[model samples]
Target: MNKTRSPIVQALLAEISTFDEAAAYRRMLPAGCYTEPEFFAFEQAEVFSRTWICVGRVEQVAERGDCFSWEVAGEPILVTRGEDGEVHALSAICRHRGEIIPCPEKGRALRCPLHFWTYDMQGRLAGAPRMGDAAAIATLRETVRLTQLRVELWHGFIFVNLDPDAKPLGPSLAKLEPLWAGYEATGVIDVPPAMSDTPLPWNWKVQVENFTDAYHPEFVHHGTHDFAPSIMPGDGVRFTDMKPGDNAIVRSVPMKTPDGGMMKDGWGPDAAFPAIATLTPEQRSRVTFAMLPPGMTMMFAPGTIAYTLIRPAGVTATYAGSDRVTYGGWLLPRSTIDLPDFRDRCAAVREGGSKIWAQDVPVNVGMQAAKNSRYLPEGIYGSLETTLQQFNVWLLEAYKRADQATR
Candidate 1:
């Protein structure tokens, strides 16, 4: 397995750093990167495990004792807000004897239902009755703490890193803030997250690529054009077309109803969030969907804001971070959309996404199968796919570093 991957690994390490921006962006990642089981294992370990992955917005753990839980990269993680109003992410596996514990079950303290070993919301060993005398208990308490993962908050999003020493997620994504400035200034609130796992026979990157690039929306999401008229491709550049270091893929789309009618703006003049007063005239004409790859994205519309997450489920299935989707948002004060109506609108988008994803999954399945053909072209990038190419570069860099780490 190592021998087969040697050349691919080396090329990934070398090409990412040296690939000329001036050159044509016709090349694609190796087809095997999407189809090979061995490479998938490498990604689970090297990329997803080590990196800070977003677990949706902090709304999942907004109040004291609120919790969110999921399994990623083979490890079960638990996240909750403590009495002190601090959020913590920790190994959901109990420390006493490495037992698996189901989570998002809340109480004043986290109690392992199996053994009754208890941990505070902050993951401190709170109690283990009948284990010892005072001296022995003191020592045991010090050694039995939960394996805490690093948690960072940015613009209401919650990200947890399995690697305690990883770089700060904020500074790493500082440039992305500029992209969110207008929405942030308007005092955005999360819409209750809606998540669904779309099972794919191909690798997860296939979906990430689909999300980050504007190229496919032309054909794959052709229906989106009627509702999100910004997707109507033309000589103009799409917002998802961005350079590296931005750490974001943002696309601009018009706000339209399903029946092919354009709103005066995203929310219309009578929206609960009528329109952000701070948005420029041009900005008001478009709604923005922005993603920070692998897990987090926010769809900022004139009337409402939404937060979402996607994490890998094994090698082929992708989890919509909260199992099926937990989404929330603040309505623009001027907009007339009510909470009940807003909820329904969010549900419609979520359902629409699922419908669109059904189209993408088969397309990617074909791409995965096409790898076996001699005529399969390595990615031939178009100009609009700079964002997609940037994501590819980041993916290669991650694999290259992981390769180095193992050696």
Candidate 2:
């Protein structure tokens, strides 16, 4: 254990060390890992900072000079499309005095408001008003550049890492590659999600646990999720084998009918977006959900690939963007986009997502609140919760690796 870790974190890690995956039944993590501020801080530094984090889709910066601001592990970053036609992730803090630099308007240079220090699309210093002569300014331009973070594009999703030496992200996600081929063959376009202005009051883990848990849909989302039953007659929820070094914890549930998807009520046969003809018969019969921890979750449906971007604000505050959380975050084919009633379809999907989300809100609140209770049990997992167990294993691996690095 790292000596710098607080007593609470140390105790939590000590308990986590005793976890045995081979046991007949798996237990939930210590509540302190979810409720304590010290552990959250450690997680931010060790896991979020060191790992690959999905920021946005590559389509966001499709055109040269296009840029957007985002935060990763509490550090402000600017993702830009440079003149050279390469995507770049740069620190948004101005080098002169560390004021946050917002993305500039179209056809303009990024200018820090504090002193009007300007940087080109590539984050090279362009100007520093009234500070030096032309020669000195040229020297500053040559020397000053926004710190560049490592960026890797996987299936058009842009992932950034604060650790310069972090391993490549693609290999860790190899298991998800087979699922994408069908979606990519038809060519998908992203409708990026609008980040929620208000953070959800729960640990980020709780939000994901709620998402990955297959057992709850039957009880919690009774009316909304009946069509995609996790406890069906013969075929129900199926889980993917999570291997060592794998980053995704995935599960798929059979739809009541082939090609069924999200409708106004929720997951059903009358999908708002029409099914893609290219998907395999197997793909059309099931909906696959994959969680790329600490950052994103994806849903591979017959009609669309829905995704959610998670940004943790505090130990108990998480901001996310998805059809269920805010709006958009859909990957649809061009044919769907050209439909005259596309907006209506999108609204119906959001409505369905909202209904499902409404059911989740109260339970999430209860789960988060229980973390502080003395009565919080060492939870038991059922066979339906394989994804949750996989997630716990993933989290423990991350924590242990970070701890070992410090030692």
Candidate 3:
């Protein structure tokens, strides 16, 4: 590893003692760590129950009578398309005996497989088998509405909130209204199937921190991106001077000079990346990056608008549901771009990105392991690490809340 360090790195290292507060907080997250109880506590209460989680793509249950079953934060939930053509989210467990309603190959109604108890697509008890008389049926119906999970469809993704009292996803997302409104004006949005799962030995915060640390690219992905003469010009470099809320948006441009032998200059050799020219002035000002409260990233490139869907499986494991949308607005007729091709290409890029991430994952694991050691250094924070610090604060606060509730 390069021993040469930045003033920021030096300042943080010098103050390590100030940040190590395990009793009041927990272990400090080093460059990498394997365990974090703070992350686990948040997952149990807020992330698992209170927040609206993105479970799957909206198109999964597009047709009326269609349904999709998913497990989020250990809760079995199902989203179904009602005969009336509305989408509904409901607890997948049967109210009768806590039996799970199995998702059939294709169906609109939710039926409990164990006792043949059935609920409408809206989660109302529609029928009961052999249990009671007609007079008692009304009582059963009143008693057995499937617990509803707050679900909202945005762009082409479906987000569900375990907390009934939580702010609606729409108003919550109103902060990004400009991006969404612009996307709708541009064209119809399309979503493709996403393949993702949780990785072992890394906290969710660790993953987000890694994404923000663009400084590691050169050292971590050196073999794939740095050494590849076709992709890198010289000894490859990582971006410095990172700011919070800044996004490293990426896109492919049609070769200007017919594949000028894959320019090594990262992003572009000149200021004008051919692709940006294709966008409107408004699009030019758009920025893409990940937002907080435990979710995926938002991308607003010249012609595309989308957010990746992230669900933490455990304190240290995460799953991603990524998709995108492109529209022409009033200037151009609206049309949605098919994303299979885009996702496949991005997947390759993400694959390359993952190698770089692999280098940081160990750091999180190691930090967790060394946290209990008396010799372990205190953690440090910088402006760029504000997000990580904020996450830690949020997690610790959550533990405080959980403890208060218990007391």
Candidate 4:
């Protein structure tokens, strides 16, 4: 155990060490892992800071000079498209006095609000008013570029890493590549999610566990999730084998009918958005959900590829947004976008997603609240909960690695 970790976190790590691979499948991690502020602080420094966090879609900065401000691991960063037509992720803190710099309006340089220090889209210092003479200003321009983070684009999703020497994000996500070809074949376009202003009162893990759980839909989401039942007649939920370096925890459930998707009532046969003609017969018959730990969740449906971005704010505070949480995190083909009733279809999908979300809210709250209970059980997992178990394993590995590094 790392002596640097808080006593609570160290105790949790000791408990985590007792669970071998097979044993991990039978029990959940200690409740303190979810409920303790000290453990959350350790996670922020160890896990999240080193992981690849999905920020937004590539379409958000499609054109040169397009940029947006985002926060990763508590550091405000700017994602921009430069004159060279490449995407770059740079620290948003101004080089001079550390005031956070917001993305400027189109065709304008990123200017600090405090002193009008300006930088180009690529984060190179362009001007600093009243700091020095001509020669000194030129020297400052040569030496004062903002710190750049590592960026990798995976299937149009923009991911950034705070760790300078962290391994590439692609190989870890190779499992998800096979599922993407069909969606990309017809040329999909992203409609990025608008994050909620208010945070949800739950641990980030609790939010994702609710998203990945397959056993609860029958009881919890009676009407809305019936069309995509986890317990189908012959084929129930199918899980992918997690390899050593794998990052995604995935499960797919058979749809009641081919091409079924989100409707006004919920997931059903008469989907608001039409199915993509290019998808395989198997793809059309099932809905695959993938959780990329520490940041995002994705749904591979017949009509559209839906996604949600997870942002953890505190030990029990998480903020998320997507089709289910808020509105519009969709990737659809041009054919669907060209439909005359596309706006109505989008609204219907949002309405259906809202109903499903309403059921999830209370259950999530209850799950988070249970962590504080004196009698919280070492939870049992059924076969249907393989994804959750996989998530536990992933987190354990991250925690272990961080602990070993500190030693």
Comparing 3 and 4 on lDDT, the stronger one: 4
Taken over the whole model, the C-alpha lDDT of each candidate is 0.62, 0.93, 0.51, 0.92
lDDT of 4 by residue, 1-407 (tens): 77767898889988898888877788888999999999888888888889999999889999999999888877899999987899999999999999999999999999999999999998999999998899999999999998989999999899999998889999999998998888889999988898988899999999999999999999999999999999988888999999998989999999999999999999999999899988999999999999999899999999899999998889998889899888989999999999999999999999999999999999999999999899999988888999999998999899888888887
- Model 2 poorest 10 in a row by lDDT: 17-26
Cα lDDT, model 3, residue 339: 37
Clashing pairs in 4: none
Between candidates 1 and 4, the one scoring higher on TM-score is 4
Q: Write the per-residue lDDT of candidate 2 for residues 184-253, one digit (tens) a residue.
A: 9999999999999999999999999999999999999999999998888888999989888888989999
Query: Tens digit of lDDT per residue, candidate 1, span 1-407?
Result: 24445565445444544544433254676666665565566677778887778776676788888877776677888888887899888889898888765554656577787778888777888788788888887877787888888888887767888876677778667655655666666665554544554544556776666666666666766653345543444523355444444456666665543112112222233333346666555456556666776666655555455555666665556555321133333323324344457655554544554555566667877766786677877566776677666776666557666766665
For model 1, give the 10-residue run with minimal summed lDDT. 258-267
Model 4: CA > 4 A from native: none
Report how far residue 240 has shifted in candidate 1, in Å: 7.3
How far out, in Å, is residue 114 in model 2? 1.3
Q: Per-residue lDDT of 131-155 in model 3, one digit per residue for the tens?
A: 7898788889888799988888866
TM-scores of the candidates in the order shown: 0.81, 0.97, 0.67, 0.98
